[model samples]
Target: MTSDDSRSRRIGRRSYLRGSLVGLGTLSVTGVAVADESGNQCPAEEPDESEEREETEESNETEDQEEIEEQYETVVDVVEAGADPEGNESITPVLREVVGDDTLLEFPEGRYYMDEQLRVTGFENVGFVGRNATLVPATYHEFDGPQYRLFRLGTSDVPGRDLRFEGFEVDQTADETGIRVISVEVEDGLVVRNVTVRGVHDSGTWGPGLFNVTEPEGEGIVARFRAEDGAIHADETPNAGNMWRGATGIVVNPDHRGTLVFEDCSLGGFPDNGLYASNETGRVGVDGGRFQNSTTASVRLSGTTGRIRDATVVVDDDPHDSNGQHAIRLDGGDHELENVTVDVPQPNGDAIRIMNGVDSAAISSSELTVGDRPNSGIRIDPTAGATTLEDVAIDIDGSANAVRILGEDAEPVVLEDVRITGDATGTRNRHAIFCERSGCQFVGLDVEQVGGDSRRGLELRGSEYVVADSEFVTTHTPIVVNGGDDVTIEDTVGRSAGDGYSLRITSDSGAVGLAGNEFPDGVRDDR
Candidate 1:
């Protein structure tokens, strides 16, 4: 196995839902039992040494017989079933005749040309294994299923379950193909491992994607996968009947109601998105992956509950003023992002984006570095529900604020132990943290502006907030309150390099209260 494949397997068992379910309360509709008092959502109690030894002995005895049966169980080979290995003719007819339920179909090492979309339906426990094989699909003009794809795993009349595809390379570089690599709809256990797609797609329909899962009802795993330069035509003018017009790499459709796990997958230079899971009722868990270079968000997820842990998202290219193109976009409620790093070096790139309908989301132990742009390090839009950001670090070298909260619907957002640093001296009203929403709280926040024309460290606009036990270092104003009701500032320390009030309240509102704030005697707010 490749090194990446090994890493995928090693992290495969550590699911985000395991042991961390309690943090999500009752968000999960599947009714998986709440974690025990021991707090193990996914218990990992291994067998003892004696039990291991007995199992090993039994495995040793049956290994040879199992291997014999496995070899004998090979139901069909495409080449033996009238498929041309020299890429001369279509293989769909021959493949359809031999594929069946509980079948182990094999494709030997050869270049097979496909003129039509290969589809299977009403089957269970079907395995497609390829050994050093490559599938070269037909060009757009000659390809069958113009609105379809290269491989379709199920149909509405006969939705397959427990389908596996492994060890193959789909070469779309030879022609201007717009076909999706593999599309599947499985009720349970959809596994795609050790697969790579090399090419660009120009589809007028659903743009070409490496793997597309329409409706996954159970656990879906995609590991050791790579998609290089597979872009989408979704953003082009007047999209046709192609449902996935903007799909790039792996897309789990919004109807999914299961767990989608992506491990050790690498995607580069995709346009729309990479590794997206968009079902509000489903769960997406990404571990050990790299996503970069997209016109839209690299990793966009909208699920009921999910986690993006130990992952890296970087925007190394010039964003070219692509608005709303974030490194990571999390629209799912009750989701968690831990130990993830996002680097947005583009001009208008945003490191992390949180949008509407997101409630009880948590971002902890993560670092986001944003470049010179008009976007914030993290943006919470209107319609955002209760959220928490703890133990997070943000570094910005831009005209944008480190954190920006907008609209009235963003309420009850908490920031605890968050550190934000700005590289600019002072930008007018550009703050380390800016809030336009009500009922927000900042606890244990540390903000510093080292250089540039940036002014305030924290600014509140028409919002009710409580600032407690926070520290601010700025060149000018540290905190500003502009027309907010029931605002409380307590137990905070401020250090300024310029002669400005540490606390600036623009409105003479009776709802603003201050207590236990420390500043220089000459520069303090004594009102």
Candidate 2:
């Protein structure tokens, strides 16, 4: 029989039983066959192969001495050259020769196209590995519903296990609706390394990396929307359209239970976001990735237990075009950013910002340099949660305030070792640091501006400060501690050209503790 015919015959039985005899039923007696007299037919018997095997082979001792192997889904092996695999020159025939409980399908250095969505189900360790093999979309414009996943785990009827899709590219051109998913369910670890996906949307058709799977009927995929479970790639799926986050690039959202890893990958040009993990309760760890020119933020991880380290996020280059954007923005949830460099080189932009219920983003040994624009370098914009800016340098090279901490009527935000500086080009009333309506602790702060448009040096309004041994210097007033209670400006110093006050304390009944303070106007009380 042909390979297709054999596959047709194997899966033809609706409810065939092939499990070991030990699992037949709970046996009260081990060897006794307590017959069921309910007119049920006998189990399928094995064909007579002992006589033919004895006629051909040597002895049972020789056969018994051979390698002992268990029966499993055979892996259909195939190789690839530069050209297509026809009947002779192609590996498709050999792939067809695999025949159900078959051999492995292997490809070495070439592009392949599958007319059917390669279903790798009902078998343990049924693997498809490619040594730099690219699998292009192979179908007409109308042949796309759920049959284009480069390799899948579960299907309409069959559940999969111990399967792997290693180092393969599911490329799309024209009607490349990406990797369509009836339900991509895997049993073993789904490892995707050194793979690239492009053109998930070709005009009318669009596709995502993967989707959740439900059961065969309609009662299985109900839990697909639960982001609290883990990543968005785990499900017992029946059909398509379940938690399909519109991701076109190397996206991994496996339903909160799937551990999707992207190690040393380059992500670019997806209309929403790159390396996106929204509402996934699992930890989305990203290491050594370059996210540039993404339609949204370079990395948008909204999950509570997500992390981003050693990454570069550049929003735009031109000064006139940021489209009113800010690079490296994290909103909502508890997270960490270690060794992150957010470089916003455009106008009307911010380098790093944490706002709207964002908390516990400890900045350690990282640089946030906003280009010469009329804005603050770094901002914690009015969130009730805790945002600690520790060891972060906000160097804005424009006439704008270097860093604006706008937590008006919000929670306390902390800033430590943050060197905020403006360009030495224009000089005026722009600020190097502006904190308004917020409560923050500034420790080890170095604020400098040479020939700039920084107004009033460091301005504060309704914002209490715990200033200790802080140095603020400009061509204007050194520090403005006004409109707050319990404000302390101790061990502060500033230099002015002429007509400039050393430190201006505007709040009435406010006591200024003067110790080791150097300024042009010496206390006006004539100390």
Candidate 3:
């Protein structure tokens, strides 16, 4: 049978079995049947490999969901526990009296106003479930916490474990200055879901995000949430002339360890970094999120083994166009970024800045487009260890370099199947890729029009380099090795515009070998 017909037959069989198993009470015990009641054994049925795999995965997922749901019991309603949802009274004592082990505090659809910071500490398996309920913080003068937080989950010294805070919105717009919405310092088993914080944060010494996972231990997840500061953009009313108040959307500090997952979350129009996961001893996973209009880096993650998958960072038309804003900053970790998209419309922005001390990084299937004069699409800083950028496309619209590797190191930095385009008219960009570190290999590179103001397609200034199977179409020069030793340029084809040479080597380069390179006028040692 054809593959399609076989797939259909398998699907139909699985569907029929699923429907039958729902009503077969006796057979449901084992999820599979064997014998008949007539004393005759039935033939053993061969299992469909794909069908069995999918079913096993789904069963495990359902078991996890069921286990989580069975842990917490809805015990008390905040309104019934002397909480005045009409925005008048203090619910601190009432909320304290209602919470217990494995208790879920249910807040109905109403706006709860708090003059003082609503604090919860040292509680296990305690949760907050709200249905369209909002916690509105009073003005900065009326609020009580010296920390200026709307909700404090756990203290710094004393941590709470097995906590869940979900389905609530915190309004910090009334106090225009920076104010943290939720500050969580938990030990283990924490979940923060579907929480929204609205306002421009401008109060704290170092601006805090809407949700701050300060010192989490073990496993925790923050999903389906939004933390936005509307005024940090171009058209909104500035906080005070320049309204960027160093606001972060979601931040995890360095004290956190173990696994912390952020899924389906969003952070927009913040002054500082958005969605920061920086822990020296932890592993962070950011899956499917959008970080936009950040003044500094959009997402900065530094962990033992960090991952950012299916994430998008946008720095388009930000009003306070700062020079040091990096769309995504990977610092101090062996991180893997997959299927990430970065769009930088501002001039002085870097799409991806991999800082020093990172053990390793792998970025695959990612696209970066920078407008105006952004710094670089991807920058591998000094002291960074082995890095691999594969199947990545970069487009620079202005005078910025597409990829830049700085400082000197002997760790292998590999670029495979990478396409970089500098598509500007009057002010063409610099080199499409600039390398200054040793031990690097470039394979399958497609470069176009990256030489403006006497730049090159690829500029190398370090030793032990390999450029093979690469195509370059540039304005001024194609490849230039200013200060490098043991450089090999093989299997490369390039065309330089105007009267500029295809390959130019300065006096500082040493021991350069050019073999199998299809250039117009061979290699010119300008030394």
Candidate 4:
């Protein structure tokens, strides 16, 4: 057995002992019941079922770890295999000759230089681990043809299984420097972690990383992979004629067919979109990352079913040759955004846009804060499917609608426990909830709009709507039913601080049902 296998076994034994001890302690505490002095029995202790379950779970986890460690039977140190460690010579030739299947390639405490891409394909159970190692790539002019990437692990047609690449720093701070550090296409069980790119990408090449899982049952994770300096525009680089808009931080394209998770990654202001994983057929998850100041969007995701949870997207600075910047954009999927925080202090577009053709979406327990610009906080496009906004809060400092729902023929939307508070100061009429869709339900809504006289609270323009248990406080009319059929406002409160009516119903409106609602400034029924 190899030293790595021995070490893994020892670690697994320790983990198992630790878990057993923890389970025993829990059992000792929960298996006994105690009473107070007054003879009132404490809550009856159930059987110690959780202790057994915990022990089983820990044991299974240890087994999985040991299995992974044992697969790398052969270990090769690249420096020992006729490769230079001082960054004076290219390691690409040695890597091409020494890389093999079921091997662990180690780089120990050195700087490796490469002027060409190192391509590997159709290998199983391969790993590249680094210890205090740095990789320096050739500048744009000196790199070989198709100067896009440093390492191409696998291709879609010839994918490797069970790959791991981690623990290295990429130094691209030299003049005219840029390269895609690694592009990995795997069939199953891929892990890429702790690879930090340290500099701005100025070579007008591809982005720092691209990853994909090419099989239906495959799973992959890219964690703590940071490129915080980001990239520049292509026109400013020596390779300007070959590329467009410079590089993006990371990309996952449409050929991906399995589940991929990006966890705790940080990306800076790239010229194009940051973490653009749209147009994929499988599931993609962005969990706990910070993506900031990309041109089109900081985090744009689309797939069959996916989510963006506990992530932060900020657009504090405008990109060069600035275009619209959406903090988070979701397209063509059944997705959810939970516990997300989007702060666009220099907003150029909507904070969160659910684009057309989305099957279904939900935004829950998220906070969106937009600056003093004329962009909407959340915009649901006209052709999107059903959506739900629950436990969400929007804070706007400009004349933007808190929630703009467009599509008159779209599916029903539900907004429950949502809060909108901010100043609407523009000349145009800005409503907190601007709904043009039919068959929508608004429940437990708290909306407050201040500043201009055109700042209304809720404008419902479609048919078959219900507004229940909502409170609206605004400068203009709080509730306006301009043209809608079978609209009901029950158990709600509408208050206007200005001279406008608290509730207004235009003459062209259809049948309206009002039950147990309070309009402090009175209602104007022109019908």
Candidate 5:
């Protein structure tokens, strides 16, 4: 028989059995007996009413039990589990007793109070979700000892897996009140989202949040997390003697090993650093966030490999006890910054500082603005590795150099399609582009230093450099070969509206080759 015919026969048999069993009361059988052993037709016996009633009762009981289990299978509502949701009592004891692995603890719409930290570790598939829930933490003195965090999900040694904590509002607006809403360490798969802290962190304790992915192959994401009202100085808070400048907005420390991404977050002014993820050995990513007015730096990131894309860092206002406020500070690692916007109008440090021990760094499609300060728009350290800046525009309103390359032993730096337009009015007589590193290339540069009389365009002090396809407009000498050897400036245009030379070769400089260049003023060869 064909497969289709066999399938149709099977269907016909099933339909015949179903139709026959509908009339056979209290029995469900696959087949019916046609005759007895004597070859005479036999009739089916009827079921006893007592046995049928008992069976019906047993089936109903089984269904009821299954319904109860299905209702409480994966979710545990905290309010129904002896926890007060009206903020009348502490939920610590109830939480400690009810939380377990492979379950989700959900909070209904209410104000929940926490007087101590709730710690859970070495768990898998644990989650805490809230529906319009507000967490109220006790003040610094009222909280339990080591009163830093509201919830400590896991630790470095016993990290959890597949952890999720989301959808809660933290209320720390009371006087002398603050909290780290959630500090989670996970081995793999973490999602923390939509957690907002509603007040300044004045408790002088830990920050609003701390996240770490403990395994190298793990991954985590923190999205829409905001701590807009930042922290106060530790000395200004009730817990004065315990900590340094108060809490940071968010922190990921050196113990991190896995990749962590902070997405679409917002942080306000803080006493210490903001979004400080430096000193890590993992991959850190900051995508589409705003970090503003934090001491040290607003956004500091360093790791094995890191990226800051579509982010904004603003240092327009300084704190009361402010120190140096760099908009973005990158440390040892391979890092890239793309589509980043930085405004340091009241700058105390460099807008962007690439420190030593970087493997490779690239800043592309970025806009940087610095105020009238001594720091540079972008300062590359002496020991940093190969660096490239492409499609970058820097606006300087101070005496800061638009781009400063420091140290002779630094690797070759490349600046392509960079535009520097600013007035260097500080007394330092800074140039638009100042280079002390050798074997660098500046291509497609557009520099305009039209503010101060002593402002120059390109000051080359290193050797074996090339400046090509560039244009310079300045009051002083547009191109100055001060101490470089075998320096080439070709296919370029230089203009000076003042009485300065278009190109000046200092007496102590080495050989400089100029080709296919237009100089409205003349060149002065002092070599």
Candidate 6:
């Protein structure tokens, strides 16, 4: 009536210290064997499959049976129970074991305090399960490396391969990261589920969270070799470096397998970014999570085949950086964020921004706000990336401009059904869109409101841009095509640009594409 699969593996399996007691640092050994419960050659437990015979007897038709069930009999213990080796509750010798190949080590609930680093290496399919177990690092400025990343996996032992980390609570409360993996040597698969990394480090500003993906081809290796096979002279963009240069959180570097799953996790209150995955890190699927309250941004991502569905990203003033940076400052390649909400609180930083290096990132049905920053709400500097923001709300609590587009490699950026609104003062704080770079287009847009900031409605630079079927109201200079080439502004409506001017086009340069623009008092300010 019962199958062997119904039975569970016990924790306290017999373990022997036959491998020359490697101490606590890093254990390495070969051909080491242990005895069974009877102190003899190790024996494998046979499963009683008698129940399968009964199932076959009852059915007339034969279906494929389940494959052999290889259950991992994990060794578990509590930290307090194994605190003092001399005491009744001391760490079991089984845990300190180097862990044979394909071993599952489970720690019971409690705190473990150790001076040096505790490593698990030279293992495959190794499972480090922390069931209410906390690994506390002793010092701050004194870890194995520069970034006081407390813990590591897969060191000198061919790098821990195919590892799974689950139910572990790392103590990064006062430091930058709770746990840090130095390098995995070869391509390794890592799975981190149900974990929390908290605390704030002021010194770790440029440090990004959930970060470090390898660069497919940067400028590092080019310097080491001479010009040959189109390596150096091809992209001439002098390589930067190699693999997980400077970052925190789940990092994968150097031509390897990098895939992450963030299900029902929270990343906030960090000094810099919340979830940052970049540099040739491919194919990440993120569903359902809250990313907010970081000093810099909520999610700064780049890579290929990324889908962020059903999430909320809030960007506010950083207590550390009063300038209020972008809430979601990014430069990604072929990515999509659907059904997402990006809110920038009043006096908020840029809700969404794109700087350098991006390609084909689509933002659909999202919200972008310009809360309290003095700059634009959404700013795109320069890149050859094809980006789109569809059915979006650009609510500028009061930035001079709501969206600013720059020039870089003559890339094309699109805004469809985009709504821009701001406070009504109109004396200054003008313009809703500023086009800097060449080749940009905006369609199906609405603009309203004003502020006293002497800003323009829309500013254009030395780039080819197209603005069609748009409405604008109260503000200084509604639309102005500044320094750019092949510029087009048409089918647009504006209400007020307080005192300075309604629509001013100075910086007289480049071809202007002006058509169907409904700016009543179009002023060309020479100043």
Which structure among the candidates has the greatest TM-score? Answer: 4
Which stretches of candidate 3 lie above 4 Å from their native place? 1-69, 175-178, 202-217, 230-246, 319-323, 424-429, 450-452
lDDT of 1 by residue, 219-304 (tens): 66676677756565555523445444355677777657666667667777555676677676767777657888775678888877
* lDDT tens per residue, model 3, 1-527: 36575445334323322322221121111222333434253543445534543543353234333343345554677898889887677666677678776677888888787766667787666777776888776665566666356667887576676666778887777644445667787776666777787776544323443333344224566766777553353223223333345456677887676566676678776666777776776767776678887666778888777778778888875745555778899888788887899988774567898888798889999999888674678888878888999999988877767888887854878999999876642254457788888889999999886444665688889999999999988877788898888999899998887556788889977988888989985567866
All candidates: TM-score: 0.81, 0.65, 0.80, 0.88, 0.85, 0.65
The residue-level lDDT of candidate 3 at 80 comes to: 84
Best by lDDT: 4
On residues 428-478, what C-alpha lDDT tens digit does candidate 4 reach at each position? 646888899999999999988877856889898999999999999888889
RMSD of each: 7.4, 16.1, 10.9, 8.6, 18.3, 15.1
Clashes per model (N, Cα, C within 3 A): 15, 38, 4, 0, 0, 48
Which model is ahead, 5 or 6, in terms of lDDT?
5
Q: Write the per-residue lDDT of candidate 6 for residues 1-527, one digit (tens) a residue.
A: 13342232111111211111111000001112234556574422222324322332232112111110122433333343345322223232434553554455666666544334445556554555566665554343334434333334555324555444555454444432333422332124344444443333322312222222122211000000000000111011111232222223333232422333343345554433455555464444444467666545666666554556556776553543434545666666566666677776654466766756766667787776556556566677666467787888877766456776666555678888888775623334445676665677878877666666554566666566788888766556566766556767778776564664555657565666567777676657443
How much lDDT does each candidate structure score? 0.69, 0.48, 0.69, 0.82, 0.80, 0.49
Instruction: Using TM-score as the measure, name the better of candidate 3 and candidate 5.
Output: 5
> RMSD to the native, candidate 2?
16.1
Candidate 3 clash pair list: 177-202, 178-201, 178-202, 178-203
Error of 4 at 318 (Å): 0.8
The true-versus-predicted C-alpha distance at residue 29 of model 2, in Å, is 55
Question: What order do candidates take by lDDT, descending?
Answer: 4, 5, 3, 1, 6, 2
The superposed Cα distance between candidate 6 and the true structure at residue 223, in angstroms, equals: 38
lDDT per residue as tens, model 5, 118-225: 999998767687889999999989998678999999998898976767789999999877888998999866767779999889889989989998887666778779
Query: Which tens-of-lDDT digit does each residue in 1-527 have in candidate 2?
Result: 47665454333211111111111111111121212234244543333334422321232112210111111234333653233533123233344445243333556667665554444567533445565676665543434335434345564356554333445554554343344422354432232333455543332222334532222110011111111101111121121244342333434353443223333455554444455555433334454466654434556665444455566766654311225445555665565666677776664455665667675555666777766666456666676366677777766676766666776777766777777665633343356777775567777778776654434567677545677667766666667766555566667666653455777777342544556666755433221
TM-score for candidate 3, please give it: 0.80
